[model samples]
Every structure is written in structure tokens, then in C-alpha cells.
Target chain A: MDADVKQHQMKLIYDRYVRYLFIASACLMTIIILAIIIFVGQQGLRTFTEVSVSEFFFTTKWDPMEGQYGAASFIVGSLYVTLLAILLGAPLGLAGAVFMAKIAPSWLREIMRPATDLYVAIPSVVYGFVGLTIVVPFIRTQFNVSSGFGLLAAGFILAIMILPTIISISEDALRSVPRPLEEASLALGATRWQTIWKVLLPAALPGILTSIILAMARAIGETMAVQMVIGNTPQLAKSLFMPTSTLPSEIVVEMGNTPYGSAWGDSLFLMALVLLLISLGMILIIRRIAQRRLA
Target chain B: MSTGSRLISPKIQDKIATGIMWLAGMVIMGILVTFLFYMLYKGVPVLSWEFITGEPSDIRAGGGVGPQLFNSFYILTLSLLFSIPLAVGAGIYLAEYAGNNRLTDMIRLSTESLATVPSIVLGLFGMIIFVNMLGMGFSIIGGALTLMLLNLPVLVRVTEESIRTVPVHYREASLALGATKWQTIYRVVLPNALPGIMTGLTLTAGRALGETAILIFTAGTTVSRQLPDFDVTAAGETLAVHMWYVMAIGLVPDRIDIANGIGALLIITILIFNLMFTIPGKLLQRKMGSSRH
Candidate 1:
């Protein structure tokens, strides 16, 4: 009888111990989260205050050798290329997602979905090599240019690279819309196309936009592929057909040589901080959207 | 009404849309197919056993990336060894123990953002923290550590998802049998999640194998001549980095011919790994579905 009472007490103690372990584990996660954000902040902020913030944001020239390193050219180049990629990519990606979601037969979706997932796992370097061999040569021959690399080629490569992200996310978004809404629209004498444009699209707009921004963030940070195809020219190019520099290309090319007394290193850090902010903003927006949807 | 109806029938529009969709699919697939074609075209002709086995040499005579290939495997294995267990432990803790609360959400958000953080930024962190702060020279260990960090978030997410998929009834059954929580999770939950864990680890290994930029800042470029005697903690070049250096610096002009060959090999290896992860899960799903029916 005494042994049985001891066993019951032991069980109570073990239960409390398990709860303690759970709380400790939760604390560990919180600590790691703080560590990552704090580290990024420390590294990023250390460099930003070292240089003129306006010069980093506004100027067009980026001659690291001459010590005139404004990220303006890189920023413009990044935005322009990303914008071009979205213009080319989002519509096609949306169409593809919609087709797979609403139009494709079940067998086709089964085949294509796996194929798309496989596409996402292919590394950026292989994509770079692909862009180098196929896109570069095609551009050179068609445009009769001296350099095979061009912004258009980079944008096109990025568009392809981002397609899977857009497609998968948009497909999920579209899939989540209630079927009753579509049924109701159809019953109200609306055509399928009308139902799609007026009903389904409006419902999925936020998610589709989220996917777009996510893709844009991806395009901005993509390094190796864009570096290979963008010609790594530091100067801003007027035409999409011409080669230009983006923030990622600049960081990759210039980080190797710290170039003492030059703020190029600091500039690189600032660019990274900007990229981080953009990604953080994206996540916050996504969390809000997800919360509202869940609610 | 007759003219308007004839101009654009619902059937006609649907047909056109379907046709356009098919055309778009074909075009995009064409790009992917063309890429594979070009890689094969440029790569296959030059691919010989000697080319694969030889050591990389001077600018004039292109040499083999034998050393780089070995380094890649070593770095990949080491990175996976370091990351998989830590991430799995952390993941199990998250999925099984931690409640769905603000703290857990914060951890998850940080991890997701970490996933989006550019490889270059991670590379920078590695340079500062691993190379400079830790006093580790640009060596294989530093690169491996950096790669481990880079792959951690993905592994954690995958592992957590896999663990969560283990049926609740299994846990309840184990508890009912008088097992402790730890014992139940260890015996029932982990065994069930093992295949999925392997899938995640395989994908992570594939990424580590292909990584270059992070290694560029962390791993120094001195390629050791001997294979078996090679110390991984020391600086060495891997296959992907070798290819990048070959093209960018043109340090070995003759070896540039083999770049595509090396790339093709890497891509094929990664594709195989991806299939290993995805195909099994898919086949298992199909089997389950058929059995249910």
C-alpha cells in the first residue's frame, strides 16, 4: 500500500517535470529567434551608419575603384530587372496556376505538380549555367551584340526561376476559395470566364499578390544566375537589352576585395539590410493575411 | 443577338483558352527541355572517365576536378552530419512539446525569414562570425558550419511537418500501454517520421553539394593534391565552386570545356536525390489511397 502511494507521487512529479521541459524548450526557441534577428541587425547596422544614407539610396554611379559607391545603380538595376521579370512572369505563372487549379484534368495535375516541385529543387547555379549557355547565345545571335549577356536575359532567367514559387503559392490560394462561391456565380447566369475573373480572382487576389511580392524578393536576392547573365556591369544601363548591375551582383563581385578605406564593404552591408527589411515586411504582411484568413 | 452570340460563344472562348494554356505549357516546358538539351550537347561529348578523374591544372591544359569532387562529398557529408541531428532534436521539441503560442510563432517566423535571407548575406555572416570572429581561417570546416546553418531552417520545418503527420492514435496507444511521453515519441512517432526525415536530409544534402557562394567567403581556394590524406578542416575547393572559379577567373582556360560536364553531373545527381525524396512519398500516398478504396 505504501509502495503504491509512492508510485502515484512519482507520477505527479514526472508530469510536472514534463511541463517544465516543455516550457524550457519554448524558451530555447525564443532565444534562438532573438539571436538571429539581433545578429542580422548588428551586422547590418554597423555598416549603415558608417556611410551617407542619402548617397547609398539616391546616386546613380557606383565606381568602387574611385570610391564613389552609391547603391543607386544597383538598386535601380535590381528594381528594373525584378519589375521586368514580374511583368513577364506573373501573368504566365498566374495563368499556369489557374489552369492547373480550375482547368487541368486530374491526371494532368498529378503529373505537372510533381514536375513543378522537381523544378523548384534545381539549384540556382545550374539555372545560371542554363542561362549562360542557351539564353546568352540566343541573345547574342539575335541582337548581334558584342557581349552575350543582357538584362533581358537575366530577367527572363529569373522569371523562369520564380515561376514555381508563384505557381505553387497561387495554386494553393486559388484552391482555398470556397466552391460554393463559384457554384453560385455559375448559377446566376455568369459564364465560366466571368466567374473566374469576377469571383475567383477577387477572392485570390491577396494571395496572388503575396506570391508576386515573394517572387520579387526572390528575384532581388538571386545572385549567381543574375551575375552570370547580367554581364556584371557596375554602370546603369539604359536599355533592358544592355548589361547592368544589381545589388546582389555588386555584393558578390565586390565583397572579395574589401578595398581598404572604401565604403563599398559598408555599402554591401547596407544593401543586405535593405534586402532583410524587404523580406521582413513581406513575412509580416503574409502573417497578417494568414491570420485574417484563418479567423 | 444572333451575330453577338456567333461572335463569341462560351464554347469557342473555352476552346481558345484551353489552346492558349496548352501552348503556354509547351513553351515553358520547351525552355526547360532546351536547357537540358544544351547541357547535354555541351557536356556529354567531353565527358570521359579521365576528364572526371583528372586533377584541375593550369590555364592552358584543362584538367580534371577530381579533388573538387572529393571535397564536395566530404563537405556535404560533414555539413549534413552536423545539421541533421540538431535540427531534428529542435524540430521534435517544437512539434511535440511546444504549444502553439506567440513564442512558437516567433521562432517559426524567424526561421521562415532565415529561409528567405539571401545566401550571400549568410555568406557574409559566415565571413564575419565564422572566419573573423572565431579565428577560423578560410577552411572547409568554416564552410561546412555555414552550410549547416543555411540548411537548418528548411530541415527543421520539414522534420516538424513529418513528425506532426504521425497519427495521434499512435501516441494515445503508446500512452495507454503505460509508456512515458519520451518513450512513446521515441518508439512510435520517430519511427513513423523516419522516412520523411530521410527525405528532408537528402534534399538538404543536395543543396549543400551544390552550394558555392557561402563557401567562396568561408572556404579558401587551395586545392590539396592528395585525396585520402586531405584534411577537410583545411581549405579546399568543391565542384560547384571549382566551376565558378573556372568560368569567372578563367584561371584554367582548358578546363573551362569541362564546366558544363561537371554542372550536368551535379544537376543529375541533385535531380536523382529530389526524385528519391518525392517519388517514395508519392508512391506511398498512392498505395494508401488504393488500400483505402
Candidate 2:
């Protein structure tokens, strides 16, 4: 009895120590996040020391070799492609979500579910390769454009990339809209279309919006696929078919050439910071939507 | 005419709406099929024993990606090695120890923020710390360390989710039988959660295998001369990165063929990874699931 008591005491001490270990591992995530923000901000802010903040966000010229560091074009280009991608992706993704959640037979749903997951698994670099080989040429010849690499090509590729994100989350949202509400609508003599649009869509609006915002975040930060097709020119897009550059793509294109401490390299870091901030802001918006739904 | 159309029936509208839904599904699937076929068609013709193991040429025609192919698995292995334990520990904490407290809230926020930080931004972070500050230069070690950041949030989220699926009764019974909290988790909870966790791991590995941007800067886009180089400090270009490099800046005459081959190889590997999870995941679920209850 005395030895057993001693062994139990030892076990209790070990358990307490293990709990601390788990807590430390969890805290490490916070420390790493803080490190990223601080380090990226420190390197990125060095660009403003040479080029004023206003010039970086307002001017179009990006000739870093000649000391011109204006980044208005890249910022604007990112905004345009993101919006275009959302416009094309959201409707189609939402339609698919509704079909999977409400309309599709169970067997078809099972098949398409993995199909969508596999779509997400397709590497972005492969998407870029496809854009370069097929989409760029097809756009050029079909549209009678001088070049096919521009906002349109990048936006089209991104729309496809973000489809799975929107579809999966929105499907979950639609599926969770209590069956009683659907039955009530049907009992009132509403058609299936009216029940979905008027009853289900409004009830699940917050969740659907969250998915859209997340998809928008993904589209904005997409670097490899956009870099491959966006033509990497610093000009503001004259038309959908004209060559342009986004913040992420511009950074990828130039980071290899510039030395790490040079203003050119720092400017790329700043672009990355801008992308980081935008995505973080979207996350906050998503949390707000979730809180509203809970309340 | 509009009033007459409305008078025609709600039945017609529902049918039309249903038709539109079917069309949307068809369009999405159509795009997926076309893209897959296009990649495989352009790539499969370029694969061979020579291309798989031959040395890459600088400006010559018939270069292969032997070094890059090796480094991809090498770095991926190192990253999974680094991330899995830390993430699992953190995940167990969230699922088992964390209560509704300020510390737990902060941890959750940090994980979400880490996930949202774009991969390119993560690349720069890795390059800043590992390559420039730490003096590793562009190397396999730097790349693997950065890739761990990409993997951590994903692994933690999955592990937490899988652990949550284990019934609370098992934990209560273990504790009632004099097992400590850690023992209950180690011997009972983890075993029950293994199937889902394994599936999550398989998916994470697939994503890491094809990851390019993070490796591009940290690994420095240049492969070492030695095949199967064990040196962690050597340059580690991956197949995905190789495809991008060939398209963007490679001077080799057979650049197109090389890119196609790498693309096809990556796709084939994705298919295999898919099989690895779905089959074993189902069998394990059937075997262990009933026992867990």
C-alpha cells in the first residue's frame, strides 16, 4: 500500500509536466505568427525609407533599375484580377453547392465530392503551365489580341482554382439550414426554386458569404498561377487582353534578380506584406459574420 | 407576357431552375476533365527511364530532373518529420486541455492567422530568417523549415478534428480506471483517431509534394550536381519548381518536353496519393470504428 501510494504520486507529477509540454507547443504557434509579422514588416518597411509611401501606392512607374519604385500598377492589377475571379467563380460555385446539398442524388454527390477535392489538390504550378500553353494562345487567337497574357487569363485560371473552396463550404452551409424550414416552405405551396432562393439562401447567407470571402482571399494571394499567365509587365491593364502584373507575381518575378537588402528586394517584401494584411482583414470579416450568426 | 409566364406555373420555374443546376455541375466537371486530360496528354509522352534518372543539361536538348525529383521527397520527408510531432502535441492540447480561456483563444487566433498568411508571404518569411539571417543560404534545410510552417496549421487542424471524433465515454472510462490524462490520450484517444489523422496526413503530403513557391526562394531554384545528394545544405529545386523554371527562364531546347514530363509525373503521384488514403482510410474506419464505441 505504501509503495503504491508512492507510485501514484510519481504519476501525478509526470502528468502535470506533460500538460505544460502541450501548452508550450501550443504557445509556439503564437510566437511563430508574431515572428512572421515582425520580420516581414521590418524587411518590407525598408522600401519606404527610399521610396515614399504615397509614391509606392499611387504612381505607375516600376523601373527599379532607374530608381523608380512606384507600385500603383501592381496593386491595381491585383484588385482587378481578384474581382474578376470572384465574379466568375461565385455564381458557378454557388450553383454547384446548391445542387450537391439539395438537388443531386446521393450517388452522384459521393462521386462529385471527391472530384472537387481532387480539383483542389491539382498543383497551382501545373495550372500555370496549362495557362501558358493553352489558355494564353487560345485567348490570343480567339479574341484577336496582340497578346493573351493579362488580367483575363489570370482571372480565369484563379476562378477555377477557387471553385472547390467555395463549393465545399457553401455546401456545408446549405446542408445545415434545418429541415423544418424547408418543409414549411414546401407546405406553403412554394416551388423548389422559391424555397431555395427565398428560404434556404437567406438562412445560410452568412456561411455562403464567408466562403466567398475566403475564396477571394485565396484568389488574391495566388502567386504561381498568376505569375505564369499575367505577362509580368508593370503596366496597368489597358484591357483584359493587355499585359499586366499583380503584387504577388511582380514580387516573384523580381525577387530573384534583386539582392536581399536592396530597395528592390524590400519593395517585393512590402508587396507580400500588403497581401498578408488583406487576407488577415478578410479573416476578421469572416469572424464578424460568424459572430453575427451566433448572436 | 410576363404575367402570363408567371401564370403558367411554379412547376415550370422549378424545372428550369433544376435544369440550370445540372448545367452548372456539368460545366464545373467539364472544366476539371479538360484540364486533367490536357496536362496528361502534354506530359506523358515525355516520360522515360532516361528522363527520370538522367542529369539535367544547361543549354543542351535532353536534360532530365533527376536531382530535383530526389530533393522533392527529401525535403518533404524532412518537413513532415519536423511538423507532425509539434502539431500533434498542440492539437492534443486544443482538444483535451484547452478550456474557454484567454490563452486558448489566442492560440486559436494564431493558428488561423498562420493559415491565412499567403504561401508567398510565408516564403519571404522563410527566406528572411533561414537564408539571410541564419546564413543557411538557399538550401534544402531552409526550404524544409519553411515548408513546416505551411504544414503546421493544416496538421494541427486535422489532428484536432480527428481527436474530437473520439467519443467522450472512452476518455471518462480511462480516467475512471486510474489512467492519467496523458495515458488516456496516448493509449486510447490517439489510437481511435488514427484513421482520420492518417487521411489528413496523406492529403497534407500530397499538397507539400506539389508545393513550389515556398521552395522557390528558400531552396533557390538550382539543383545540386550530385544525384541523391544527402547534403541538406545543397540547393533543392522540386519538380513543380522545375516546371516553372523551365517555362520562365530555362535556356534548354527541350524545356517544353521537360515541363510536360514533370507536370504529368506530379499528377500521377497525386492519383497514387489519393489511392493511398481512400482505401486504407475506409478499411481502418470499418475495423476500428465499432470498437471505439
Candidate 3:
């Protein structure tokens, strides 16, 4: 009887030990986040000692060979591409979501839902390949541009890339609206178009905004596909037709050529730090919006 | 409220709005279909049995992606081998043990942030920590470690969600039957969540296979001409990287065709993996539903 009791006690201890192990694994994410922040922070900040933070932020030139490491141009380039992508993607995705949720036949939704999922699964590299072969050439020929690789190409590809995220999230937001709300809008003599524009969209604004922010974050951080089509110009873009480089693409193009721990490499880390900060802020906003929706 | 206030009648406005929505949907569907068909049309002629089995040649006209294909699977296996246990464990803890607390909140926030971190930044982190700090160099292990980190947040989230979807009553019954908590989870909960977990794993595998920016830095872009060496320290490049190299720097005339072939191969592989899990997932859901009824 005593031996049986002892064996049971050992089993309980073993169970508790395994539970702790699981808890520790769960905490690994926190540890990794902290480690990445600190490591990237340290490397990024080291560059500011050599070049003043203001200069890095304000200067437009990014000639690494000449020792000019200002990231203003890349920052602006990222903003320009992202903004254009949002302009192109948001209306299409929102309208598509509206159609899927409110107007589409059941069969159409079935087809679209899987197609959107597949779009999300399609690799960015493949998108890059398609852009290089088709979109860039088409843009060059149609628009009479000297080079097809520019902000327009990157923005156009990013717009398509972000459509899945926008459509699905906005669709969920639209679907979550109580049917009574739509019924009431229609009962008030509002036409279907008016009700959708003035009522459904306003009600779903927060969720739609969340989706937009997430898509913007994706557009800003997109590296390889943009790199392939963006023409890799280091200067501030004069127009959508002109070539430019964003922060991530700049890092990808130069990180290998630049010696590790050099001013240029550290500058790339600083850009990454900038990217991280922007994304973290966006995540926090998303979380807040989500919590608000729950409440 | 005036008659001339609106140029179009409400009926016409409704029609126009509906028309625009339909156009948007058609455009979305049209883009995806065109991309798939165009890629297949361009790539199919180049894809042959010899292309799949032959070694890649630097100067020759008919080099294949044989070694690169092997390395892609190799790195994916290594990463998944390391990631699954930790992710599953973390998932279990979050689903079953974590109460609504600050620690749980922090974990969720960290996972969210990690998910949003760009692949290139993670590659830089991997370059710093795994390759340089750990002295692993640019090798399969380093790349795998990076990929594991990249996929862990998604895996954990999916696993936690799947476990949570297993009815609470199931756990309660197991406990009432005098089963240990770990045994209850291992035997009852995990089995029920297996389909969902499998779906998540397949998606993660697809992501790992198509990843490029991360591997470019951690797994240096050198393809071993021979059959893949299992050594973790050896540099490796996957199909995505191979496509990137061929398109960007490969001066060969047939580079575009080669890239097209790789892209088609990648799309087909991903499509297969997705379908494999999704079909099983649908069947599992139906079975669970009927059993409950």
C-alpha cells in the first residue's frame, strides 16, 4: 500500500514537471522577441554614433560607397509604394468583400474563398517572377517608360498581393454585422447601394481599418518581389514611373556586399529597427481594435 | 431632398454598385487564373523527367534543379523536426494551462509581433545569432533554425486553436475517468486535433519550401552538384533561391524557361500539399459533426 502511494506521488510530480516544460516552451517566444529587439537595437544604434540620427533620418542620399547613409529616400520610397498599393488594393478588396458577403451567389463564394486562400499561399517569389516577365514589360510598353522597374510596378504587385488579406478580413467584418442592421437600413427606405455605402461600411470601419493597416505593414516590409521589380534606385523617386529603393530591398541588395559591422551594414540594421518599430506600432493598434470589437 | 440633387435614380445607383462589385470579384478571380495558366503554359514544355532527375549545369543548356529540390526538402524536414515539438507543447500550454493573465497576454503579443516581422529581418537575425554568434556558418542547420523561428508563431497559434476546438467536455470526461492530465492531453485531446494540426503543418511546410529571403542569408546560395549531402554545415539553396539566381544573374538564354519551370513546380507542390490536408480536414470535420449529433 505504501509503495503504491509513493508511485502515485512520483507520477504527480512527473506530470507537474512536464507542465512546467510546456510553460517554458510557451515563454520562448517572449525570450526570442526580447533577444531580437536587443540585438537589432544595439547594432542599429551603433551607426547613429558615427552618423547623427537626424542626418540618417533627414538626408536623402544613400550612396554607401561615398559613405552617405541617410535613409530618407528609402523611407519615402517605402511610403510611396505602400500608399499607392493601398489606393489600388483597398477599394477593390472592399468591394469584392461586399460582393462575396452580400451579393454573390453561394457557388461564387465557394469558388472565391478557395481562390483567395490559394492566392495567400502563392509565394512572393512567384509573384516576382510573373511581375518581371509580364507586368514590367507591359507597363514599359503601354506607358512608354524607359524602364518598367519603378514604384508603379512594385505598387501594382503589392496591391494584388495584399488583396487576399483585405478581402478575407473585410469579408469577416461584413459578415459579422447582425442581419437586423441591414434589414433596418432597408426598412428605412435606403436603397441597397446607399445602405451599403452609408451604413454597412461605417459599421465595419474599425475592422476594415485593421485590415488596411495590416496590408500596409505587409507592403512596407515586402522585400524580394519589390526588389525584383523596383529597379533598385537609391535616390528619392521623382514620380511613380521612376525607379526607387525601399528599406528592405536596400538591405537585401547591399547586406552581402557590405562588410559586417561596417557603417553600411549597421545602417541596414537601423532600417530594420525602423521597420520593426513601425510593425510593432501597427500590431498594437490592431490588438486595440480587436479588443474594442470584443468588448 | 430635391429632385435634381441626384443625377442617377436610386435604382440605377444600386445597379451600378452591384455592377462594380461584380467587376471587382471578376478581376480578383481573373488575375489568379491567368497567372496559373500563363505559368503552366510557359513552364510545361521545359519540365521533363530528365529535368527532374538531372544535375544542374552551369554552362549547359539543360541543367536541372535536382540538388536544390533535395535541399529544400532537407531543410524543411530539419526545421519541422525541431519546431513541431516546441510548437505543440506551447500550444498545449496555452490552450489547457494558461489562464487569462499578464503572462498569457505577453505571449500572445510576442507571437503577433513575431508573425509580422519580415523574412529579411529574420534572415538578418539568423545571420547574426545563428551563423555568426553560434559559429554555425551559412549552413542547413542555421537556415533551418531560422525557418523554425519563422514558422513557430503560426504553428503554435494553429495548434492552440485546434486544441481549444476539442470540446471542453472531452477533457472533463477524461479527468473524471481518473486519467492524468498529460495522458488525457496526449491520448484524447491530441488525437481529436490531429487533422487541424496536420493542416497547419502542411501550410507551414509550404511556406518553408517557398521561402527565399530568409534562406538566402542563412543557407548560402551554393547548390551542391551531387546528391544532397546530409551534413548540416553544408551550404544549400532551394528552388525559390534557384529561381531568383537564374532570373537575376543567370546570363544563360534559357534562364527564363528554367525559372518558369521552377515556379510551376513550386506551385504544383504547394497546391498538392494544400489539397492533401484540406480534403482530410473536411472529412474530419464532417465526422466530428456527425459523431456529436
Candidate 4:
């Protein structure tokens, strides 16, 4: 009896220690996040000290070789591509979500659901390669452009890339709407189309909006695929057919070549900081909307 | 009433709406199918046993992706090795031990934010912190560490979810039988949650494999001409990076063919991983009767 009690006491101590250990492991994520923020912030802020913050952010010229380091054009390019993606993807994604949730037969759902998951699983680089070989060339030939890489090509790739996110999230949101609501609309003699637009979509509006915001976040941050198609010109895009660059793409193209402590490198870090803040804001907004829906 | 009748009937409107939705669904499916088959059709002509096993050549018309394929798996293993333990531990703490409190909320928020951070930004972070600060300079270790951060959020979320699905009675029974908390978790809870955890792991592995932006900066774009060495500090390019490099900068005569081959290979590998987890995931879900969203 005495030996058994002593073993049990030892197990209790071990459990307590392991529990704290797990907590420490959990805390590690917070530590890493803080470290990233601090390190990036420190590096990024150096750009401002070297050049005025307003000039760095507002200047359109980005020739780092001659010391022109404004990122206004990249920021605009990111927004333009992301906006185009949202315009092209959001409606189709919503319609597809509605079809899957309310209209599709079971057989079709099974096939399409797995396909969607696989779509998400495919690497972004593969998308880039496809865009580079197929879409860019096609655009060049079809439009008779000098170079095929442009905002339109990047936007098209992003549209397809974000389809899975938009579809899944919006489908989940639509599915979560109670069955009784739809039944009541039917009982009131509302048409299926009216029920969806007037009843179901409004109820799931928050979720749909959340998905849109999330998809927008993804499109803005997408680097490799966009870099492959967007001609990497650090200038304001003249038109849909013109080449442009984004913050992330610019960093990818220049980070390796730039000296570590140079103002150009610091500028890349600043771009990263900006990207980080935008995504964090989106995530927090998503959480807030989700929580409000739950409440 | 006849004169006031609308041009389009409500029934027609409903049909049109339904038709549009169906067409939208078809568009999505069509895009996916076209992407898959087009890639395969273009890539399969060049794919061969020799291509899979032979070393990449810069001068020759035909070079294999052997070094890149090996590097991909090598870095994947290294990252998983570094990430799984901490993610599992943190997951268990969140699911079992964390109560409704500010600290838990903060942790949850941090994980979500980590999940949303752009891969390119993470690439920049890795380049600065891992490559420069840690003095690991464009090596496998640096790449793996960056990927570990990227995959941890998903792994922890999956672990917590699976742990939650392990019926509370198992924990209570283990405790009632004189098992300590850790003992119950190890002997009782973890055993039952193994399938779910495995599913999470498979998914995380897939994410890590597909990652390019993070690996691009952390893992150098250059691949060893010879067979891959076991050294962690050696610079290596993954298959995805290889695909990018071949397309972006490769001046070889057969760059297009090689890029196509790499694309096809990547798609096939990803499809295999997806199927591997999904079929078993369905079976496990059915067996456990645990309906996960």
C-alpha cells in the first residue's frame, strides 16, 4: 500500500510538470509572433529614418539603385489585382456556394467537394507555372501585347486560386443557416430564387462578407504566382494589360539581391510590415464578425 | 390580369436562377479539371523513370529533378520533426487544460494571426531572422524552421480539435482508475485521438510540401548538381522552387519541357497525398462516428 501511494504521488508530480510544459509550448507561438513583429518593425522603421516616412510611402518611383524607394505603386498594384480578383471571383464563388448548399445533388457534391479540396492542396507555384506557360502566352497572342505578363494575367490566376477559399467558406455559411428559415419562406409561397436572395443570403451575409474579406487578404499576399505573371515592373499599372508589381512580389524579386543593411532591404521589411498589419486587421475583423454572428 | 402579366414568369425566373447557379458550379469544376488535365497532358510527355531519378543539368536539353525531389522530402521531414511535438503539446493544453480565460483567448488570436500571415512576409522574416540572425544562411535548417512556423497553427488547431473529440468519459475513466492527468492523456486520450491527429499531420505535411514563398528565401534557389547530401546547412531548392527557377531563369534548351515535367510531378504528388489522407480520414470518421466540419 505504501509503495503504491508513493508511485501515485510521483505520477501526480510528473503530470503537473508536463502540464506546465505544454503551456510553455503554447506560449512559444506568442513569443515567436512578438519576435517577428519586433524584428521586422525595427528593420522596417530604419527606412523611415533614412528617408522621410511620407516620401517612402507616397513616392511612386522605386529605383533602389539610384535611391528612389517609394512603394506607392506596389501598394496600388496589390490593391488593383486583389480588387480584380474579388470582382471576378466573389460572385461566382457565391453562386457556386449556393449551388452546392441548396441545389446540388449528393453525387455532384461528393465529386466537387473533393475536387475543391484538391484545388486548395495544389501548390501556388504550380499555378504560377501554368499561368506563365499557358495564360501569359495566350494573352500575349490574343491581345497582341509586347509582353504577356500583366495585371490581368495575375488577377485571373488569383481569381482561380482563391475560388476554394470563397466557395468553402461561403458554403459553410449558407449551410449554417437554419432549415426552418428556408421552410418558412417556402410556406409563404416565395420562389426559390427569392428565398435565396431575400431570406438565406441576408441571414448568411456576415459569413459571406467574412469569406470575401479573407479571400481579399489571400489575393493581396499571394506572391509567387502573381510574380510569375505580373511583369515585375515597379511602376503604376497603366491599364489591365500593363505590367505591375505588388509589395510581396517586389520583396521576392529584390530581397535576395539587396544588401542586408541597405535602405532597400529595410524598405522590403517595411512592405512586409504593411502586409502583416493588413492581414492581421482582416483576421481580427473576421473574428469580430464571426463572434457577433455567434452572439 | 392577362394584360398585366409579366414578360418572365416566376417559374422561369426560378429556373433561370437555378441554371445560373449550376453554371457557376460547372465553371469552378471546369477550371479545376482543365488545370489538372492540361498540366498532366503537357507534363506527362517528358516524365519518365530517368527524369525522376537523374540529376538536374544546366547545359543539357533534358535534366531530371532528382536533387529537388530529395530536397523537398528532406526539408519536409526536418520541419515536421521540429514542429509536431510543440504543436501537439500546445494543442493538448488548449483543448484540455485551458479554461475560458484571457490567456487562452490571446493564444487563440495569435494562432489565427499566424495562420493569416502571408508566406512572402514569412519568407522575409525567415531571411532576416533565420538566415541572417541565426547565421544559418540559406540552408535546409532555416527553410525548415520557417515552414515549422507556417505549419504550426494548422497542426495545433487540428490536435486540439481531435483531442476534444475524444469522449470526455475516457479521461474521467482513466482518472478514476488512478491514472494521473498526463498518464490519462498519454495512455487513454492520445490513443483514441491518434487517427484524428494523423489526419491533421497529413494535412500539415501537404501544406508544407506546397509552400514555395517561404521556402524560396530561406532555402536557396540553387540546387546541388550532385546527389543531395544529408547536411542541414547545405543550400537546397525544393521541387516547387525548382519549377519556379526553371521557368523564371533557366536558360537551358529544354526549360519548358523540364518545367512541365516538374509541374506534373508536383500535381501528382499532391494528389497522392490528398487521396492518402482523405480516404483514411473518411474511414476513421465513420468508425469514430465523429462528424467534423
Q: On residues B109-178, what C-alpha lDDT tens digit does candidate 2 reach at each position?
A: 8998898788999999999999989999999999999999999998999999999999999999999999
Best of the candidates, TM-score: 2
Q: After superposition, how far is residue B224 of candidate 4 from its true place, in Å?
A: 3.1
User: Per-residue CA lDDT of candidate 2, range A114-164, in tens?
Assistant: 788788789999989999998999999999998899999999999999999
- Chain A TM-score values, per prediction: 0.88, 0.98, 0.94, 0.96
Residues A12-106, candidate 4, lDDT per residue (tens digit)? 89889999999999999888788878888889989987778877778898888888888999999999999999999899999999999999999
Predictions in order: lDDT: 0.76, 0.92, 0.89, 0.89
Candidate order (DockQ): 2, 4, 3, 1
Can you write out model 1's per-residue Cα lDDT over B191-282, one digit (the tens) per residue?
78877787777767777788877788888665776864357567867888877776766566565476787887787777788777767866
Candidate 2 lDDT (Cα, whole model)? 0.92
The DockQ assigned to candidate 1 is: 0.39
Better of 1 and 4 by DockQ: 4
On DockQ, who's better, 2 or 3?
A: 2
Residue runs of model 3 more than 4 Å from their true location after superposition: A1-7, A187-191, B1-5
Q: How do the predictions measure up, each by TM-score?
A: 0.90, 0.98, 0.96, 0.96
> Looking at model 1 chain A, which ten-residue stretch has the lowest summed lDDT?
A24-33
User: Which residue pairs does candidate 3 place in steric collision?
Assistant: none
Candidates 1 and 3 compared: the better one by DockQ is 3
Among residues 3 or more apart in sequence or in different chains, the pairs in candidate 2 whose N, CA or C atoms overlap within 3 Å are none
Question: Candidate 1 residues A1-295, lDDT tens each?
Answer: 9998898678768866765664554355445445545665676565555556787688877776786757787888888889888999888888888888888789888877766665666667778878887789998898888777768999989999888889889989899999999999999987776677789989998889889988987888888888878998877779877888888777888777885224667667667677667777777887788788778
Local error of candidate 1 at residue A271 (angstroms): 2.1
